[model samples]
Target: MYRTPALLAPLALALAASAFAAGEHDHAHEHQPLHGGVVVEVKDVDYELVARPAAVQLHLRDHGKPADVSQASARLTLLTGTDKQEAVLRPAGGKLEAAGSFRLAPGTKAVVVVTRPGKPAATARFTLK
Candidate 1:
């Protein structure tokens, strides 16, 4: 009986070491983002709102775990040349997309604000080039 405990101690230590090594291996291939917390992907479909040729299409994707977006709200501000327009986004096709009246061009700067239910609001800035 005493020998069994002695054997178990070594086994536990070996298992722990293996787990640590595996974690280190995973870290090598992991790509860490600049900021922490969940990430939302925003894609402008047909809009450039900056360069002045294509219409803007904003695609907001939840890169984190799936959560309810019923209460979520989003606002996008697009700066195109000398004009600026604000778009209020609504949830559509599991993403929030807002269409602007004017065609936004590439290399334009945009501000997006997303508010999820029961979570603090998040804001992101992107340049569509």
Candidate 2:
């Protein structure tokens, strides 16, 4: 009857809206860590941050391929409770690394900013668990 169509119209519209929103999201991007680090995606690139008590390492991948970071540098800001610390990471081997004693623990948050000449900086936030 006419009432049946009217009642299904709202459901159809809701389903269509959800499908549209999902199609626009990048959930298909691979989020698995390549170096046992927390991975975050920014601007179609994936950044992995590995935190340890003795050193920190960052890895970058674009479209599932290793990104060239030879001319890149990174700064990291780590926040844990009321204590905060910072470190500068430079290109080492093929990744950016900083060597120092760090105060890392569960629930810590880290913000990383990577900069390269003639390119905009890429930033990502990670929470350790």
* Candidate whose lDDT is highest: 2
Q: What residue runs in model 1 are displaced by over 4 Å at the alpha carbon?
A: 1-67
Model 1 scores worst on lDDT over the 10 consecutive residues at 43-52
The estimated TM-scores of all candidates read: 0.51, 0.84
- Expressed as tens digits, the lDDT of each residue in 1-129 for candidate 1 is 358888899999999999888855322222222222223243211111222332333333334333355667677787878888887766655546555465456656677777777767767776755
Residue 120 displacement (Å), model 1 = 0.8
Candidate lDDT values, in order: 0.54, 0.91
Judge candidate 2 against the unseen true structure and give its global Cα lDDT, from 0 to 1: 0.91
lDDT of 2 by residue, 1-129 (tens): 459988899999999999899868554667799899999988888899999999999999887788888999999999999889999999998899999999999999999999977879988999998
Worst 10 residues of 2 by lDDT: 22-31
Candidate 2 C-alpha RMSD relative to the actual structure: 3.0
125: Cα error in model 1, Å? 0.2
Instruction: Give Cα distance to truth, residue 119, candidate 2, Å.
Output: 1.9
